[model samples]
Target: MNLQAVKILFLKDLFLSRRQLFAYFAAGLASSALTTIPNPTVSFVGFLLMITVAIASGIHLIGTLMLSESTDQTRLFVMSMPISLLDYSVGKIAVILTTYLIPWSAMFASSAILTFVLPTSKHGSFAVLPAIFLFLLCAFLIQLVTAVVSESVGWTISVMVGCNVGLNVFFMQLFASPEISAAAKSDSVSWPPVLIQLLTVELLIAAGALVTAFIAQTRKRDLV
Candidate 1:
């Protein structure tokens, strides 16, 4: 594999992703700040904004760093370089995953902090927010794997939309669950049995999907 060429590709993708990442980070921070206020309507708006930040970041990064390269004129130039398919595969995985994780991690940390700091009544169940964030991560991984394996914008977009809908339904169900609503009165974070199982499932799915994507990449004859 051409390490230098891979490094260049990684850097190029990172540079291309900077602006969208900044906007996502800013919106996530804003959402966290919104939790500081006690208004229900404003907090609801904030929750929506947080979801938007998470989903939008994934969509943009997938397009700009992963899918766009395949359609761009750069594809031919990249293929003609010293880079092998392995190098291209490595660069795509590293660049797309790293670029996504930065803003995602920020959003995760901010949500965790907000969940902890905010009153139980204001945020509902403590573990719920973290679970939601994990779900988003899982959803993004599903999108990532879909894009990596299918290399089709249509499939990726379809999965994204489906995941988006699933997320909304999941969010409502989590909040509405008796375990979550009951724990909203507690001062401590509640890890109800069902919630714990859900979190574990999401974690497993995220890890499994990523590993699958890497395997598919390794077996590929072409990355361009």
Candidate 2:
């Protein structure tokens, strides 16, 4: 792999997509703020906004940094360079993570802090936030894979529309179940195995999706 090429690609991508990056960060922070509101209706709106930001952020990055790269003149310029498939894939993955994860981490960390400091965990148990945040992270990774590997606008958008919002809703409902809520409320430290297992599965799927996307991108004969 050409480390220099990867570095160049990262800087170029970041520079090109800087505006979107800032917008996503601000939107995520706004969602976090709204989710902390004391009102029930407001809080629900915040929750939906958070889910929207999660999915929208991923889609925006995929379009500007990945999908758009293929259809525009920028991609041609990058391809003219001495970068290999591995270098290109690594650069794309690096930029996607950098662009998405930094803001995501900030929003998530703030939410976690507010959840405990303001004591707003749904069932009064802090464990619930981790489950919620992890699910979003996991979903974004799978969505990233869809966007990168498929490289088909229709397929990528279809998968995003079909899964991201629905999975978020399903996971929210799952955590709200009586069993999980009871366990979360009963013991803050010792969470139920079901929650733990779900978190583990999310992590595993995220890791697998990332690996799959990387391999698929590298194996391709062309960028698109």
Instruction: Provide C-alpha RMSD values for all models, in order.
Output: 2.2, 2.2
Query: C-alpha displacement of 195 in model 1, angstroms?
Result: 1.6
Q: What tens digits encode model 2's per-residue C-alpha lDDT throughout 1-224?
A: 88999999999889988998889889888888987888989977987887678778887898888888777767777777788877887888889978988678877787767766665564346566677777777777777788778867888888777776668586768767776778667524457778788789878988898889878877788653
* Model 1 lDDT tens row, 77-195: 87797777777767877887787777778777777777666654544455676688888888988998898788899999999999999987997888778887776656666677888
Screening candidate 2 with a backbone cut-off below 3 angstroms (N, C-alpha, C), the clashing residue pairs are none
Instruction: State each model's CA lDDT, in order.
Output: 0.79, 0.78
Number of the top candidate by lDDT? Answer: 1
**How do all models score by TM-score?**
0.89, 0.89
Assess the local accuracy of residue 39 in candidate 2 as a C-alpha lDDT between 0 and 100. Answer: 91
* Residue 109 alpha-carbon offset, candidate 1, angstroms: 1.8
In model 1, where is the ten-residue run with the lowest total lDDT?
Answer: 118-127
